[model samples]
Target: MTITGVDHTPEVLTVRWQDGAATRFHAIWLRDNAQGAAFRHPGNDQRLFDLTEMPDDIEIADAQIVAEGLEIRFAPDGAVSVFAAAYLREHAYDRAPATPDQPVWGAELGRRLTRHAYDAVRDNPSARKAWLDDVTTDGIALLTGVPAVEGKVCEVAELFGFVRETNYGRLFEVRSEAQPINLAYTPVGLNVHTDNPYRSPVPGLQLLHCLTNAAEGGDSVFVDGFRCAQKLRTEAPDAFALLSRHRAPFRYRNAETDLSNRTAYIETDETGRIAAIRYNNRSAAPLDLPFDVMGDFYAALRRFSRALHDPDGEMRLRLEPGDLVTFDNERVLHGRTGFSGGARHLQGCYADKDSLHSMAAVLSRKSA
Candidate 1:
């Protein structure tokens, strides 16, 4: 096995392989991947190509050894990719090989749930943030002790830096009365799914607060859609790949408004890591694909949907009057069980991921 060598110096190093091949790597790539937020944030960060594509077709061209690192021209594209000597020495590229069959739910879910729970309340000065960080990995955070009020779920969401508005920025209401916003009857049992699949940029997070839950059988349900996707990848790789490669249409319309969009079942980050899952049977419109693959796609969708709805694969909880459940709308699938006759009023609001992340950062700084 060939061992990669690392050198630490003020200037970039000229690496020469035993095969008599030489190339100069600069500091730009190292600086961009820095753990510090100074290089990770949007406005203040350096721009680079997708990380997953880094190894492919990369070759060093003209090289300039600088005081801090090497300035090398990348081949073909002639783009500059850098590697800082100090940064290279500090970081290791040999990450533990990822286990393809590892389970991503359960304990892993608990950790993420806790982190979100901690960040959710670590900011509010007036509120007492008492929550179980192990609510589930599906991004559910419970905020307790908030004064229960009718039609004030938006207020609770606001405390966590979430703005109150619908996917379309229209003021939407949640009621048990007739004729709901989506033309679907109110208080019906909604499938475990994300909201506003029709919007290009679907709302990232959702907050649902219980004002009154005296009625029975309306307990909230959550499922880690990412976990389900991982399972699909393991058990049915072809189906998983097909879903990830194709786009499915989603639509939502009321008499007054109509919205639609197309997105894949598996969403990936810059590193090709699966980041989110948006599955909603109610909002799914007719898919546009070749007839042969369409049948298989629907079959795969059915199988995944079955897995999601399985009782063994879900986490169930009942929100009390003072309880507020906040979750990542993109990563978690949420639904309500059928409730019988009684006043089970709940109010909800939508917020973007950016706001939640901002809240987490502010809280982290305060704690720090």
Candidate 2:
């Protein structure tokens, strides 16, 4: 957008754009956002000065449209700042904020699940970017034709970010065990739930790669926790409010390790937008709410659990050897059916979402 004209007061500056839109910029905001080398670090774009150093009564002395963008002169200090036209439009605060691009889905997603071949993602930047984008938008993705070997899950994680090693080590095994330390090592059917809710900072992403799968009935299942939360928000507002308002405790303990955390079942940001979902029935600790609220809490919890187990909310798939799945650990609940007879084996690992997002952004810039 090109700036056509400028009108200003001591405190605010209004710019008229070529598209016939007018945007008002606060003098303090513009002063703080100066992108010049003297004001910000060129390498990282971090601000050079502290906010406390800025004059409290700063005002705009004058403003004008320049060839590069919009230029403003500040009073007192007489410092000149220029901003690109595109930058101003991109950061305009006068308009309503854009809705998040994330798309929530349920069992219907099974019909057209986001999928990418392992070899293609390894060799093609565009293919990897698309797959990462899929995981970001839908909270899950699948990869076929993986090597079906040990520790391959780590390699997939490296494509985006380093593995987040926990007490389970760099990569954990998944299969029936003689004396299972965790319920996940058993052959019994598991309920749809998030992983490691007991940790302070739960794993942001999870990768499960199948090395072998000859068991009779070990199909994998996924549920969109975001979808479940939204259903409660729309159908049971009181339940949703309670779940988001109160904290639930979760814990995991063994001989050498004991981890515990307390968080809202349905987490929300300052603007009340859903931020994350932490639900793990097996790991939840005893209730500690007030006596009066205990009954209501349990009722709300049951309603939320029902939403999670709704048949229409589940997507089921049977993984074959060489197949791998990646999902947002906080947003997608995973489980499996009981199996017996033949052997079934898989490898899993954890990683953070920030690194995945960083990789996607760099790839996008390179492609552009």
**Structural similarity to truth (TM-score) of each candidate:** 0.70, 0.96
Candidate 1 Cα deviation (angstroms), residue 326? 0.5
lDDT per prediction?
0.64, 0.92
Q: Which consecutive 10 residues in model 2 have the weakest lDDT in total?
A: 94-103
Q: Residue 157 error for model 1, in Å?
A: 2.6
Q: How many backbone clashes does candidate 2 have?
A: 0
Kindly list the per-residue Cα lDDT of model 1 for residues 59-94, writing each as its tens digit: 445555566554455555555535454454335343
Distance from true location, Cα of 362 in model 2, Å? 1.1
Per-residue error (Å), model 1, residue 99: 8.8
Q: Residue pairs in steric clash, candidate 1?
A: 10-67, 11-67, 12-69, 12-70, 26-82, 26-83, 27-83, 27-84, 109-137
- Scored by lDDT, the top model is 2
